[model samples]
Target: MKRRLEPGRLVIASHNKGKIPEIAALLGPYGMDIVSAGELDVPEPEETGTSFAANAELKARFSADLTGLPALADDSGLCVEALDGDPGIFSARWAGSGKDFGRAMELVERNLAAKGPEAGRDAHFVCALSLCWPDGHIVTVEGRVDGHLVWPPRGDKGFGYDPVFQPWHHDITFGEMDPDRKHAMSHRADAFRKLVAAVF
Candidate 1:
């Protein structure tokens, strides 16, 4: 039997502003209070797990234990099929030196140079969400968005690898889409939709 999800004020176990607001907005309709870990100044656990699900649970369980409240954590990133999922977990660090994505994208372009775009230059964004209760029980869900890659990032909306990832449904990249449009189709949105239906 599956455990029930208890609802109340919960902590979003992450410091990324890009992720925080979208999650909060999604949770608002559920009548659940959403608080960020940064707001509470809680220390994040090291994400040593090799998989997205493992990493999300590590952080969520840690935050739930710390805040004594149900907590939600998400591990997300872009995965290039040609790169053999090269920046899967290291997507954040890929942008070395002051979180400069321009440099990061440059690295990806360089890495793919030998492979050539036609040789399976496809990519996708993956998101894993974990919700942990104060009682030590946890539940997890995952979402992914597949699409081919486009070089030389585009637009100014959204953050992270948004500029380079263009979902299968649209010709424009995520960064070029409107905020509401991106939020509706993103992997994060897909995961949160399941979370809302299952928990909130």
Candidate 2:
């Protein structure tokens, strides 16, 4: 049987401003006291893991061990079919040291264009969530959402590659879609649902 997350203080092991709020919002309904690793001055750990799940576990364990509390971490990325799943685990690194996603988005467009017209716009997002207790007990889950890429980008609402990626059956890009709507069907949400089912 999986260990349940008892309501109380939980550390969200991430420093990304955009990600922390999204995660906090998801955990809002649970009524747990949420704090971010950034808020606690927890240094970001090196993501040496080769896969999303491994990275998520690494971050969660790092924070949980240091803070002596339960920690949750999310490792997510965008995978382009034409790019051969490139920028997958390295999604954040694509943004460069300053974390400028606009530049990263442009790079993606440039790479895609270099492939010629026959190169498909097919793409997907992957999110892996890990929950860890201070004692090292952990639970992890992964989720994905399929979509295609677009040029010129879109709304400024979402961060990262949201502006250019439109999910299947949706006419608008994630950046253009309503936050609540995106949260309902996002790759992160999918992973959160699995996490909740397994541990909440």
Candidate 3:
């Protein structure tokens, strides 16, 4: 049986500023004191894992070992159908050294164009979350939200490829939606819901 996460201080094992806040907000209702790896000067471990679940577990284990606290980590990215998941794991690397997602999105657009319109722009966001204890116990869950790509990326409310992704049945891109709305329909939220059900 999986162990339940007790109400206490937990470390969020991530260094991304954009990701940290979203996680905090999601965990807010749990009444746990959440501190980020960035805030605690926890060094980011190399994402040597081939998949999101593997990476999430790697980070969670790393932080739990360091702080002796339960840790949560998520590894997420956009996967394109035509590109055959070209940037699946390398999504962040595609953003380049400056983490300029604008440039990253442009590259995606350019690459898509090369495939011709017939290739289609179907894509989806995937999030894998892992919760780990210092003793090596772990629970993991994954979630995905499918959508297609759009040109002239809209809105500035979100980071990464949010501006170009329009989720199924949604008229607007994730970037165009308010944070609350985005969170409700997001891959991270989907995974979070599962984690909450299992742990809390």
Best by lDDT: 2
Estimate the TM-score for candidate 3.
Answer: 0.98
Query: Any residue pairs clashing in model 1, and if so which?
Result: none
lDDT for 93 (candidate 3)? 86
lDDT of each: 0.87, 0.95, 0.93
Encode model 1's per-residue lDDT on 35-125: one tens digit a residue. 9999999987888999999999999999999999999999998899889997898998899748888888888888999886476778999
TM-score of each: 0.94, 0.99, 0.98
Residues 1-200, candidate 2, lDDT per residue (tens digit)?
76988999999999999998899889998878999999999999999999999999999999999999999999999999999998999999999999999999999999999999999999999999999999999999999999999999998887899999999999999999999999999999999999989987
Output the lDDT of residue 150, model 3: 99
Off by over 4 Å in 3: none
Candidate 2, TM-score vs. the true structure?
A: 0.99
Best by TM-score: 2
Model 2, C-alpha of 169: deviation from truth (Å): 0.8
lDDT of the structure predicted as candidate 1: 0.87
RMSD of each: 1.5, 0.6, 0.8
Give the per-residue lDDT digits (tens) of candidate 3, residues 1-200: 85789999999999888898899899989998999998899999999999999999999999999999999999999999999997897898899879999999999999999999799999999999999999999999999999999999999987889999999999999999999999887999999999999999
**Backbone clashes in model 3, listed as residue pairs:** none
